[model samples]
Target: MASQQTVFMNHGQGETSYARNSSIQNADQERMKPMIEAAIAELCTANNGLSRGNIVIADLGCSSGPNALTLVSFAVEAIHKHYLELQQPPPELCVLLNDLPDNDFNTVVKNLTTLRRSDEPVVVTGVTPGSFYERLFTAESLHLACSSNSLHWLSKAPEDLTRNQIPAYDIDEHARRERLPLVVEAYANQFKKDFTLFLKLRAKESVPGGKIVVSLLGRRSEGISSKFPRLVEILLQILSVTASEGVFEKKKLNSFYVPVYEPSDEELREIIQEEGSFWINEMCVHGLTSGMDSALITPNRLANQMRAVFEPLVAQHLGDVMDEFVRTAEQRWSLEGSLQDEVARLATVAVSLTKA
Candidate 1:
């Protein structure tokens, strides 16, 4: 099958910029490192002299430049530490950075240039590149694949919940629920296809029993019922109210939510099992607290962060009215009684899967 491809707004905040500049600094990497190291250690133990040769790693959805660099550096350090324990020479490393074509390729190139300046002999390849859901690299060419905080985006908006089918702004519970299945189906289908392709590609490219570590936003429910956590529901409420006020256009709102399918751990496990190329080695759910506590912090800061994350979608649909929409949304939240609880740190779930 020809690899499917689509283009969306760049969301210019590159991976590195988003990670470094966000309120949550290294929070993602810190949570993921131990899991990654353990997986690598296990892989080395299974295969004698696996750490002795060139080791190839790929970071899927390696947004912008700095984000990829951060992951590559972490992987390299981890591998080197393992080599020390094994009393073997450090493996030559090849790190492939992959992302959508519209991503900040220039920034990634620049950041990697600086890394090359170091004395260490690192072969960094920039695969400027393609979607992770589609084929982006050769078969059986990778030792490990790592993707963080990016899988939530499906290749396209779900077909059933497209702009035309979405209910009017004042949609009630029944109508929302009725539409919810289609929305979930769209996300689920696309994710299944994309992830299946990812697993197949990884299996062909990676050596036997290579490791794949992915950290993404996950929820504990498969349906759109009240089963979702309170915090996510609150965020949805804020989004709905703002969207109804025409701050975010109806189409953008639908597109934005279409791919936000956070599967429960059991649901995720089932998906992996069906794919048949990976084994669920380890998994954990870590709350992604944004750390915006402190009573002195202003509402504007919170608003700005929300805007930064969603502005691309808003601008795409709302045209010139995007800023006005955001302002009105902020006003609504303020009137609803300052979002004190909403200010608490958000949580994210991470999982590590290995080749079967």
Candidate 2:
């Protein structure tokens, strides 16, 4: 394992941008509509119609592009519908979009302004730029906080890995087949600390009895993927082969690792229990095949999707070898036999919680 500079998704709306490659995340967000609606309904009812007050909703990790405001749209509508049913005037809304400082907030802000002008004229939109792992809002001011396809990202790579130490064993296969704390101790420990801080910070900002809905990639079973396909394994394989061929210095490959973790149900439950700020109103895991799905998945499209997500960190790591790296990725991914057959079994986990 190695350290990560921690970059956001590909910025522009090109063929290889997150705006185009995020269909998988968009699908999961749609699947979560019922859960989100229920949460908002419960929240509105609990607040006794919330007549004439402002409801504060925050979308954590609301990265740029088409998927940025998906949660916000769903939440605003749900809040309105519930109040309408109660025959009371709907409350004013404060919709805050949050992500890392490097996120493409310019695009997000433009889209938000367009959305409000075209339809949601009364909604107020603001950007909160910082790591979601830290305090980004006022205490006890949030009514609901929703995050999608995020939370699996650690604020920073573990210190042990950042010191440029690479384990001798195969970490990818280790993550899928079995979790050896001996090998993954640093990664596992980092997730525990990051997630705990996330919850603690949110708990301070969220009002008592507020709702939280989070959807993230998870390790569904011992052999299951963490959400989308395990592209990291393929990437590492590419780097290793190139390094062996003297394409780049082996040390470069040794000094690069993507910082991502996929936790199990047991791990999540235990953390929530230990944190003790919220109740698990609901927790469910679903296997999805939506990424590069519906139509047959092509190697070209798959390469582009991976690029949208990983290119920033990968390009930075490879430096002068970036062009060769991209070419090899496309060619090698094409040779991944039966990927079209296996594109339908990704895993995602969703949990809805209430502040205690």
Highest lDDT: give the candidate number: 2
Q: Which digits, one per residue and each the tens of the lDDT, describe model 2 over residues 1-356?
A: 34448669988787777888887788789877888899898887785324447788999999889899999899988877787787776677889999988898888998987435454326788999998988999988898899998888777766775674644224355543453344366777888999999999999998878888998877565664233224455667766766666777776665666776767767788899999999998888866444335564565665566677777887787765545665766676565565554444446778999998
Question: How many residue pairs clash in model 1?
Answer: 12
**Model 1 TM:** 0.79
Q: List model 1 lDDT by residue over 80-134, tens digit each.
A: 7887888876667777888888766776776766545264455566664887766
**lDDT agreement with native, every candidate:** 0.61, 0.75
Off by over 4 Å in 2: 1-4, 48-52, 117-121, 168-181, 222-231, 242-247, 290-293, 320-337, 340-345
Candidate 1 ranges beyond 4 A from true positions: 1-21, 48-52, 85-87, 163-174, 221-257, 290-302, 325-340, 343-346
Per-model tally of clashing residue pairs? 12, 0
Worst 10 residues of 1 by lDDT: 1-10
